[model samples]
Target: MTVRELLTEMKDTSEVIIDLAYASLMYNSSTMAEKVRGLEDDMDDLKFATRYKVLLSSRTREDARQLSGILEVASAADRISDAASDIVSLLRFPPEKRPFITEMLSEADEKIRMIKISSDSSMVGNTIGRLQIEASTGCKIIAIKNRRGWTYDPEDEMKLRANDVIIVRGTDDGADLLVEYAAGRKEWEFEEIVPDDVIEDEAEEDLQNEEELSEEIRGEGDEE
Candidate 1:
């Protein structure tokens, strides 16, 4: 990959790894902690690749001066990944000792939660767009893990299945409501939703039709 691509990957990896690390703490899941560690390794590899590319491309004083900034940014992203790794280290301690941490997270304005979809859930066999998940429950899904693997910032068309695990971020109330749907404790109920892109397209079409009608009326008046 090019240096620019490597840096971009590093930045994205750093952000997502940090979120997942905190989520591991919130859910007390060793599985999530392991995922963080795997990403930390990827971050290390990205840092090395970025440094190598930057150094190989620098052939003069001017080149070095211009490329130094890239190295600095890469180092900063590396530090962020390191910090995320440290956060997951809290998992090594006993769960009883971490109640205070969970308490603090609960009091925050927004929280991260992991929900497992049950077989009997009404959410089964539905796409995220069809269910209008965020619109209906106010929670945004950040990632999903299933038999296929982990998907970050999952698309609206991604379908839900039984035993799928989703990570969501939102207010506590929203998370609670979504949890009920995932656990099959409450049925999902909401009015049908039209996607924002579809609404925008329809509005643009209407505007174009009005303009065409105005042009036709002006042409008739000129002929008369």
Candidate 2:
């Protein structure tokens, strides 16, 4: 890949890592946290690949200077992903006991969600941009997984296919709405005045209680 393409890919993966990591924290999912770590490893490989390619291509002092700037930008993206991973690392602690951290999470306005396109779904054969997910449901598609593997920051014309897993970040209500639409359940779509389930843990009932307590301590009501 060219340096510009690599840089764009770096930015795309960077967003996915951080967003998914923070989502892991909010849901207390070790599985998701580990996934972010795996993605971080992928990012490291991309970094090395970009550097190696650039080293071979740098032929002049001016080229070296610009390449250095590109490397710096890529490093900054890596750092942001690292910071998000650090946040996920703290999820090993119980949320109830970490009242401060839980409080912070409770206040998060954005959330991560994933939806799989069904074979019969209207979204199956359209481009992401054509779907207008952000414009329609206020959700941003960050990554797409298919036979081609994960495509981060796909262009407007990038085709959506059956069984493509789309990762998105947006408000809880918006994400829910989008999930239904993406899954060919448009009839089930509705405005979520209060999200039905905010926590993704298997022991959701207990976690909900803990979250309620955390909110009470923070002088907030239970999540609907």
Candidate 3:
């Protein structure tokens, strides 16, 4: 099959997985078990298609390797989903039996805290460095969402403008502390700043090198 056809099939399979997840959330254990089985089947089909594409493509070995790695990740996700479904099924006994299960799920969800912040303050600088220094409580900046772009790396150095959303990952207490600080109720100290352009240039250079390597492999294949 062509690349476009493979990608379309993958999208459809992803939709089925999402639907199964939603059904599990709303239905009982018996019903969700069946849906989870169906999702596992769809995931297997996607894994087969991904592997087929990588095996058939001949332009770049690096591209094939990357696609193979993606298939591996998909397989792992499918396994984790199936295991979770099994655990959920065991909690269908009685009201008293479900307390432990409920507690476990709640604890798992509470560990990963997500906090949203706005960069429209006057004391904050325009880049991530200032935010990192200002929010100095061992909290890490995981993602940045803006009107112009969305980044998921620590290397993001774009100027934070008004209405920009910054997603920070930390503990529950740390996230709460950040929210309090952002609301002007708490005091914070500042530190040195770094230019955004320097980080952007490094990222650009890395991308350029990867592209050049791919092009070189394509040219060698053409010469043969």
Which candidate comes out best when scored by TM-score?
A: 1
Candidate 1 clashes: the total is: 0
> What are the runs in model 3 whose C-alpha is more than 4 Å off?
1-29, 58-60, 91-95, 106-224
Comparing 1 and 3 on TM-score, the stronger one:
1
Candidate 2 residue lDDT tens string, 39-124: 78878888888898889889999999988998898898888888877888888788776676656655679866668888867777
From the highest TM-score down, the ranking of the candidates is 1, 2, 3
For model 1 the TM-score comes to 0.69
The true-versus-predicted C-alpha distance at residue 7 of model 2, in Å, is 1.1
Please give me the total number of clashing residue pairs in predicted model 2: 0
What is the lDDT, from 0 to 100, of the residue 109 in candidate 2? 91
lDDT of 3 by residue, 40-128 (tens): 66666766776676676746878767776766665665565556456546535664655654454335523223344445343244466
Which pairs clash inside model 1? none
Runs of candidate 2 exceeding 4 Å displacement = 112-130, 141-168, 172-224
lDDT (Cα, tens digit) per residue for candidate 1, span 1-224: 99989989889888878878888888888877888899899889999999999999999999999899999999999999999999999998887988987887778787888899999899999999989999888887878998998876688999999999999988889999999999999999956667999999999999999999999999896787
Give Cα distance to truth, residue 51, candidate 3, Å.
1.6
Residue pairs of candidate 2 with colliding backbone atoms: none
